[model samples]
Target: MLLPFFQEDLVEAGCDEAGRGCLAGPVFAAAVILPKDFYHPLLNDSKQITEEQRNELRPVIEQRSLAFAVAQLDHKQIDKLNILKASFKAMHLAVKKLQAQPGLLLIDGNRFSPFKRVPHKCIVGGDGKYASIAAASVLAKTYRDDFMKELHNKYPRYNWAQNKGYATKEHQAALDKYGPCRYHRKTFRLDYSQPRLVTMTPSVNSLSLNSEVAVSAE
Candidate 1:
């Protein structure tokens, strides 16, 4: 079972991002402050679940969480600041939108750009270990997939509905056949021979929660 909170005395928000590895579409992030007692057997790392499961959990999380917000930075912003900073900026934007301010932030990844006065904890696989982080992951992934599906409607040739802009073999083949569209990331190495986004590491400022209980990286 996922831990409910890092500490007992403060409002905590779990944060995560989606679509960093995509060849196109905006990178999205979500900040979810779930109740201390929130629990769902299906909650886990977004990547570990199927599309159906993520979608199912999105509403459950929204209905149960204390406060939640989702935000994104598009291809232009990604190009201007680079994907890493854009991801951090997106996370910051989401955090700023929460109806209730969080005293502590549980960030899914190991690096973050820190949200103003709020402190944060970065877990290597936080979504699988923390209920709030898993909730954020569901929101981020489901919302990003929805955005990509909309983009797919206008640019069907890219098959974004299927690949969600990942560097998949089919996506590369499409880029080769029709070249890039207005939504494509011009700054990215868009070659078919290029590796997937998982091979990359984006640099950024680190964040950790105040009085956080540290768990070894998974």
Candidate 2:
């Protein structure tokens, strides 16, 4: 069973991010302030649950939580700051949008960039150990998966709906044949041998660059 809170008599928000390791799509983060009495037998780390379970838990978490917010940092921002910093920024943005200010932040990972004046505790596997962090993980993963599914509609060749923007073998094969669309992170190692895709004309390049966009769902 997951613990309810790290500190007693304090409003604590759990923070977690998803898609930081993906080759495409934005990194999504969620911050959730659950009720002190919140408890669910099925709640755990997002990775441990099936898609159906995550989807089911999302609405439950949102409905039950005191305050919850989701945010994302796009591929461009990830390339600019690197994935680690981008993940942190996404979490920070989520926390900023929360209706209830948390006295403590329970971060899922081992490291977190301090958010404003909030104190935080970094638990390496907090998602599995804490109820609120598990709830946040579910929201982050489900939101990012939904966004990637939408992107897949625009570029079906990449098979993003199935791979969810991960660097899978099929995704690499698609990159070899079609090169990369604007949504592909230019900083990531798309091609080990070639390193970079063939340069396109100014107009086409501009269009492709503009296509690399982020979707925000809160």
Best by lDDT: 2
Per residue, candidate 2 scores C-alpha lDDT tens digits across 1-218 of 89988989789999999998898878899999999899877899999999999998988998889999888888888899999998998899888888888999999888999998999999999999999999999999998898888777767888999999999999889888778776678888785344454444223222223312332223
Residue 175 lDDT in candidate 2: 84
Using all chains and alpha carbons, the TM-scores for the candidates as numbered come to 0.87, 0.88
For model 1, the superposed segments whose C-alpha errors exceed 4 Å read 192-218
Instruction: Report lDDT per candidate.
Output: 0.81, 0.84
Q: In model 2, how large is the Cα lDDT of residue 154?
A: 69
Error of 2 at 130 (Å): 0.4
- Please write out the lDDT profile of model 1 over residues 1-218, one tens digit for every residue: 89999899889999998999998978888889988888888999898999999999988888888888888888878888999999998888888888888899999988988788898889989989998998889898998898778767667877999999999999999877777766778799987443333222222112211111111100
Error of 1 at 17 (Å): 0.3
